[model samples]
Target: MSVQFVGLKEINGPLVVLDNVSNVGYEEMVELVLEDGSVRTGRVVLLEDKKAVIQVFEGTRGLSLTNTKTRMLGHPMEIPLSTEILGRILSGSGKPIDGLGEIFAERSADINGKPINPVSRTYPRNYIRTGISSIDALMTLIRGQKLPIFSGSGMNHNKLAVQIVRQAKVTKDGGQPSDEKFCVVFAAMGVKNDVADYFKSSFEESGVLKNVVMFLNLSNDPIIERILTPRCALTVAEYLAFEHDMHVLVILTDMTSYAEALREFSSSKGEIPGRKGYPGYLYSDLASIYERAGIINGHKGSVTQIPILTMPNDDITHPVPDLTGYITEGQIVLDRSLDLMGTYPPVSVLPSLSRLMKDGIGEGYTRADHSALANQLFASYAKVQDARSLASVIGEEELSPIDKNYLEFGTYFERFFINQSFEEERTIDQTLDLGWKLLALLPREELDRLDSKLLDEHYHPEDARMFRGA
Candidate 1:
């Protein structure tokens, strides 16, 4: 038998308070029956002193206190999982929206998945090539790593995200795709209809829709759904990676929107606000989502994450990105300044980093000189910035010839190295070789960070011209 309440004590934004309730567990699913015989689903979010607060997944637009009845389902929210989920488009609430009908699930699992034991976690290795020069040659993304992309509003992060999904590959030595299974799980939270359609059509046009699973929570959808979007997507990823043994790349975009939803819900509950009006448990809440990514011991597959969030006012100190920086492995920060310069995928390589980059590159994984070339590129770019600042203080003609060379290097570096078409995908070797090609524009003696042996083999200007000619 189930417990049914005749009426709600109070109705708040997306929340219904049931007073004098007993034995109601947190996160227990609830079903609301309206007078018109329509049913909606919700879950208990707060339980205290014989009172329970249920958050309805569907918006509470048509319900009234006298006409609404709530039933406790005695269980938490769970998503049906199966191999058939691939190629399907689902709503944030995990319902099929593609008109393909329901999936025959193998089993239902909790959306909030269990944390992997620390001892059971295998160190992440191997590289997932994103085909972007800035990412591949500099901040290399390793399998089982959680790297976030930080952007601001009006930036083209959506295009960048799609490009990564379209071009990313799992590769071993010689830049060949590994025999391991690879797939993508993309989730969009609080996005506009056009943005959602863009992702769907982009995947379909690229002919990779069969290997991608997409969950979309649109702007007009219930706010509660935004909170569940990434979790529902990751649940599918966890099912695919651990149970079916597939390398899954999970992309959750506009996490700032998700965070905003959290703030709205928290404000409704009247909880004590933390930094910038976010919840006090914000870090743990984000950790639960991000820490789900990794390679488990004895597992043949991995779950890598590229969570994208827009920084409010491009403020790195904002709570959303600030907390994310602590949780994620590293960040690929997009620059508005670069975008103004007409750069596609305008990645700011200076602040960007990949903590797991070293483990995934080198002799056996990528080229043997990959590390040396990346280090030298970073060092030389730093000098270019200095030279530009010096020229700004004094006239360019007053600067030394070496300073002028650095300025020229910066210009070409941004044009030829950092900027690339979204449709143009480069292999790791191409990215590394291009880095050397750009370095050849500078005096070879300035390349102090590169190994002497690598400089002799890959950095000669004569060889660059010969290779370009060939």
Candidate 2:
């Protein structure tokens, strides 16, 4: 039997304190019935002996200390789960909000998910093609790996996220389309109405809405709800991946918003602040989210995560990105300078990398030449930067002939390779071929990353001269 008690302890910002509460566990759900018969929901946040501090999902505004009744529901907050959750739009708290009714749940899952044991984990291999040349050819997203995109405040990370959602796919060996089930779970926290609408319309227009599960938390929504957005999305993802044996790609955008919400919630709790006024557990809290992505040894499916967070003021050293970098496998950094140059994705090549790409690509995976092509591209792009730096000091005309070739290669590389239309989707082969074409612009001696055999197979300066003349 449940116990209902009259509440008269205290009311904080979004939290209410109850005294003499027995048998109430931390994170246990609570119901607050107001004097007028309206009810609000909350969960236990802090427990001190007989006192329980509950955080109200709906802010406590009209509750009377004397007349309000509180009831403990025994279990922690859980969301209904089913395969039907795909293609549905849910609120931050995992409630259906698309004019559709509640989910006819297969089962209810705790929002705080179970941690996957490291002993049961399988090493991640293979790749999920994003269809972006720069990412596909350079920082290939390995299935079950956690790679984050670090963006600035006003950069095109949102656009990049949508593009990935639209174009991402799981491929078989040799770049053939796989028959395995793959889906995307996208959660947007603290985004404005316009941005949320844009995500919905973009997905719908691309005809990929049926494969996507979206959890949107608006800017006006309570900070408590913002904290639940990614958790809810990940819960759905885990259900699909682990239970149904499907590959799931989870994208949590603007995690900076989620961290800020945590900071505010921490302040309300009057907890001691750590670096930059954030709670001391910020790193652990982020690890709990990033570490959830991987493949289990017994499961056929995998969960790959691409968490996108904006670096405050483009400062990578900010506490949010700094801690995130320490947890995630690798980062795709967005360049403000490249964005200003009208580059679409604006991925900063030198700073961005996927740590698992080397293991995922080449041989039976993408192509035999992928590894060498990528290395040569990186080496040549580095030279382009040096050439530009020297040209800025001396005149461009004063640079050596080899340096002039690098400058031309750099311009063509950015214009053709990195800069593509929003609708453009390139295959892994197309991306690799484009890289070789750019490499052809340089003299044979400049391409030292490739061996004599690869040079004989792919290097052709005559082709480069013909293409440049065209």
Top candidate, metric lDDT: 2
- Candidate 2: misplaced stretches above 4 Å? none
Global lDDT of each candidate: 0.92, 0.93
- TM-scores for all predictions: 0.98, 0.98
Model 1 stretches astray by more than 4 angstroms? 463-470
Residue pairs in collision within model 2 = none
User: What is residue 396's positional error in candidate 2, in angstroms?
Assistant: 1.8
lDDT of 2 by residue, 227-314 (tens): 8888888888999999999999999998999999999999999999999999999999999999989999989889999999999889
Distance from true position, residue 247, model 2, in Å? 0.4
Query: Lowest summed lDDT over 10 consecutive residues: which window, candidate 2?
Result: 461-470
Per-prediction backbone clash count:
0, 0
**lDDT, candidate 1, 229-330, per-residue tens:** 999999999999999999999999999999999999999999999999999998999999999999998888899999999999999999989999999999
